[model samples]
Target: MSRSRRRPGRCRNPNWFGQMAVQLDLGLHRLGFGMEELDHLISDPQWCAEMVPDLMLAHLPSGNDRLSQRNVADRDRFLKMTAQLSGFRKSVAASSGIFLGAEFHFDVVRPGSALFGINPMRGSANPMLPVVTLESRIIQRRHLKAGTRFGYDRSFTAEQDMLVGIVSFGAMDGVLFSPRPGQKISVFLDTHTAPVIGSGGSDTLFVDLSDVPDRACREGQIVSLINHQHDLETCAFEHGITEYELLARLGSRLPRKTCPIVLPPCIGKQGAINTRDQTSR
Candidate 1:
């Protein structure tokens, strides 16, 4: 992944080692970093003889087509290599690798992003559940003429008689600046879609609500900032940002709504004050 020198903090995928609960089998990337880690752990003959890997959890080189000839050759090499190691139950294809099909899924398969509605198949249709849905209330609505300028340095201007809502999300909320002159990123309000106008302040960005009905477009109505139409993938691409980065940066500052499931209560750890009591300190 290419990175910029200026802002070194871009969102990226998590580097998970391995977990048992998901039955993901064992895997590694960067040629599966764990493979080296395991080699280190089991280097001693005593430890090496005792340690038996259940599977070779493998990682594919990024930006390669899953079904490409190169990937096929690489997979063949990985499987052949694993053959030298006895007693493993099966092989496992990591999240994206599952899209490659039965060959990649020997005994187990791990599906991470697929659980959260991300498209497991690159450049293909998404077939997973969308676990997240974001919403924010409109703080203000303004009507402007064609010449009226808006935002930082008046970067955007009204094209005609228009209405816009100052949404409660901006730089402070981790919203990136517009990537170019005419890219279209948007938010959904009920059944209607509204295009983003521009950023106005550290705490807000504008959305074109001209086509929305007055009652629905008024200030204080909550609007969906993300949905199927302006899905995470589409928005990330539109903004010249990485999907990993875009997903990571958003909603960090937003308040969490009440969850559907009630979590069990927790007692303070010996003498530790509850969050409610700490504020008085």
Candidate 2:
């Protein structure tokens, strides 16, 4: 039986067992075997003899609450308990565990968000540059009178006469967003920003374009949903989702373009990659 608790719902299949990578539940409760569970596996002579451990993995929780004493103690306990294991050549810290300290980083590090320019260390100035930009093309434009309702369930009513543009991107395109009470969500048109004003439609989004200049409000004009100013972190924050979820939820139907990275001053003429999602017009 696989002792790692990474996937609780996954059925344990004995047929596939050849070797094992021991997962230690350091702080993140979602995966790995607990200390008591580890002890059981270690003491079981028949199981120990059959299975060989390839490596130990301990994932430390990230964000503001990661530095708790209990987590540190758990890690200390894990180290002490795993010291006797002979075969596993390395200890690896996954994801944000790399930032916890050098001790957490043993032989390897598995970085996720940091690779895509998300700040692994939150609450600090982001050291990574923007790597993705998601744009939606305006497919149509309309003028609304005050009291006119817009989108599904009539979620928004025009407060005053305003110009609005419908973009070819919405909930179906992984833009699952809703404004909080008294809050506004926006998309950028060059230097101007237009507020999203209604329930997310399946394949279209309504943006109030009254603030954007007439020249920039033309049909087929690209409006940025994710840019340097409104990066993945910001968009995810506004959507009340994680950066990983936002990235993962992006619909596969959208067109993708990969271009050489010439932007961001720090790179300075170096070769890098940037991806753009062109969500139709």
Candidate 3:
């Protein structure tokens, strides 16, 4: 049977490789071979002289002391065992295994988070495409009196009369509430950029919107979640969870208008494509 441990669930749309495995199994069944007999066919040298197992997927656990305790010795043992048992045409290192160097990268590497530019291994330079961008609209703008307390827990008490922009996006919308001191964040306004200061606990994110020079950012102005410079993995580490869990926890109630830049056509009506070919036409 063809299976993948990487995506452990029922199949909705099987790929080309999955379909081929189904066809092969049907052929074997027609030849009077049971399921166990078919399993033996690949390993038995005399059963099929020409046939050989073509691919093997290896999942190497990351050696993080806090997260997991899998080490190099465990990986080496698995690889050696596989090599001795069968002729592996291609072997893939899954997930965090991509950071394990050339030895782990037998032929291919299956990395899900690394594909989205999230570096699980701290200090390693990430080279991958960022996949998510968050944006919110300003709900209201107001001036808070000096010493005025705000939010549910009175997290921030204004030291001075400060202009604050209340955004529709909040902790519920996947915008993290907690931020480290001096952490940089941005807000997009009418093709101009505004710097926002994140200050407060991790649950209730508070941004100092007093620095916005433009008066037009009064209300209904959109702010982008800049993923380019912001490290989501680091944020998740601070929050005590995997990056995958953080993404999955994002509430669906928040009106998400997909950025046409990377989302597929089916997600939304295709936006105007800007290219030389279209410009010339």
| Best by the lDDT measure | 2
TM-score of each predicted structure versus truth = 0.68, 0.76, 0.56
In terms of lDDT, the poorest run of 10 residues in model 2 is 272-281
Colliding residue pairs in candidate 3: 177-205, 178-202
TM-score between candidate 1 and the true structure: 0.68
Residue 124, model 1: lDDT of: 68
Residue-wise C-alpha lDDT for candidate 2, range 229-249, written one tens digit per residue: 899999988988888788889
Candidate 2, pairs of clashing residues: none
Each model's C-alpha lDDT? 0.61, 0.74, 0.52
Q: Candidate 3 at residue 42, lDDT? A: 42
Q: How many residue pairs clash in each candidate?
A: 6, 0, 2
- Global lDDT for candidate 1? 0.61
